[model samples]
Target: MFTSAIPSLRWLQGFEAVARLGNVTRAAEALFISQSAVSHQIAQLEAHLGQPLFRRVGRGMELTMAGEFLLDTVGKALDHIRSGLGRLDTYLDAQLLTIVCPADIAQGWLQARLHSLQAQLPNLCPVVSVDETARYVDQVDVDVVISRSPLQQAGLTERVLFDDALVAVCTPALAAALAQSPQPGGFICLEGDAMSATVGPHLRQHFAGWSRRGMFDDARLLLDAALRGLGVAVLSRAVASEALAQGRLQCWPGFAPLPNGSLWLAQAQEPRSALIEQVVAHLLSETP
Candidate 1:
């Protein structure tokens, strides 16, 4: 009967992580082990295999041929294990929940709120997926779906994330163009999913000439265009906050403040976990 003279599963895990990350410290951090411990485990594994598994690189490590072979197989095995473990963990933490939200919300808003969620619910991990602007997420994929409002479907639970009013932000030079230009035109731009039509009645009313404006499906792209003084772009404050602070984009006070800028956090009506509320609380809590 053939058996693994390689090493224990723990040592293999350390080896795979260290090999993939190409560094002992980072691998240790990812594997939740001490660097010295990982190093020791690798050495033990190498001794058992009767060959060196790694070679020194510039302040890092690289896998030797044997190490590479083991890593290729072990990496796939570990990934499968992780996926299985994730499922098991979710099952154990049945009260934990997750959601799919706007890309901007995940990167801009929710990102800054994760610490609070961890503080409130220690086992929480918001599985964020950047999807349609107003689309509903599969209940099986995520516990909730966070998106701009004007309910697309009637079903599912909804929590307000706060109105993400569209503020036309541009550089000082662009602002001067808007103020100096005689004609009232949305010649500037506004970015979001092309599907942002589902936002609300107020969005349609305010962005009267959205067709003429620089339309984009991605907020980051529009934010970039606006930064380059392309045109005045109506953007979510959350996504533009950093640039706005840096004086890269200045808000254009040309129109009434958007009142329907509210974003909604939607979950299945019969959710099986408390993860949604935990995620919502973190997402909605004001940032200081």
Candidate 2:
């Protein structure tokens, strides 16, 4: 445990100013204080420390050995204090918006739209956090949240981003091969409580005989495996949309996707600032 024996900041400021300028009048001018006030503060500090920090040399002040040591430490400490205040200012900046969502949503949906969002709001600085377990909008300090399920918290406005569906997707070559005969490759599975519950029955009924090539906790990884021709991956339609449009992966025919869940965009009903409202509006305008 540390004792509260430290001197006041005003006294330290006076001491530092006097030490640097080497004159009481100049130090008082720099601090916007009377010379008497600076002199009083220095006197109080020296009395508190039980030692004279400065030596009177003609008309100017000179630091003693102890004063030199204290100045070095005090200068660094003041710099750190200024730096911490600067960081706080950044957090309070209106243009910095933080958006939180699941890893899959960040990678598949939000990441692509971020560039356009920034283009619209040129001063906007977005901070995105990929957290799968963040279910509530108030659970973290974020301006917006993209969730698969509706957040039941109060003081939040939610909009359905899209109705998500699970689709079986694979490379064009793999889809072509499966059209003629059952492909030799296994099924890439997304392993999570909710995802397993959704995809488990589908896989058992459709491709029970196929082996398991890879099991991933992230839908992004599952999509990547399918793109690499590792195996047929059952992933969210939104996750595979870009790839399907680009013709990198083809939807397996005869396997109609099942409605899995709805993706929602949620934010505080009373936003921190009007800038947050504009950002959220921009996001909604871009949503399909």
In order of listing, the candidates' clash counts read 8, 0
Q: Which stretches of candidate 1 lie over 4 Å from their true place?
A: 1-97, 115-124, 132-141, 149-156, 172-187, 190-215, 237-248, 258-261, 268-276
Q: In candidate 1, what are the lDDT values of residues 40-106, reduced to their tens digit?
A: 9998888888888899999899888988888888889889998998886664566555556677767
lDDT by residue for model 2 over 157-197, one digit each (tens)?
99898888888899999877766785555778688622566
Q: Rate the local accuracy (lDDT) of all candidates.
A: 0.69, 0.81
Angstrom error of the Cα, residue 120, model 1: value is 7.3
- The TM-scores, one per candidate, come to 0.47, 0.76
**In model 2, which regions exceed 4 Å deviation?**
1-6, 15-37, 54-77, 131-141, 149-154, 180-184, 193-198
**Every candidate's CA RMSD:** 11.2, 4.1
Candidate 2 is scored at a TM of 0.76
How many steric overlaps does candidate 1 have? 8
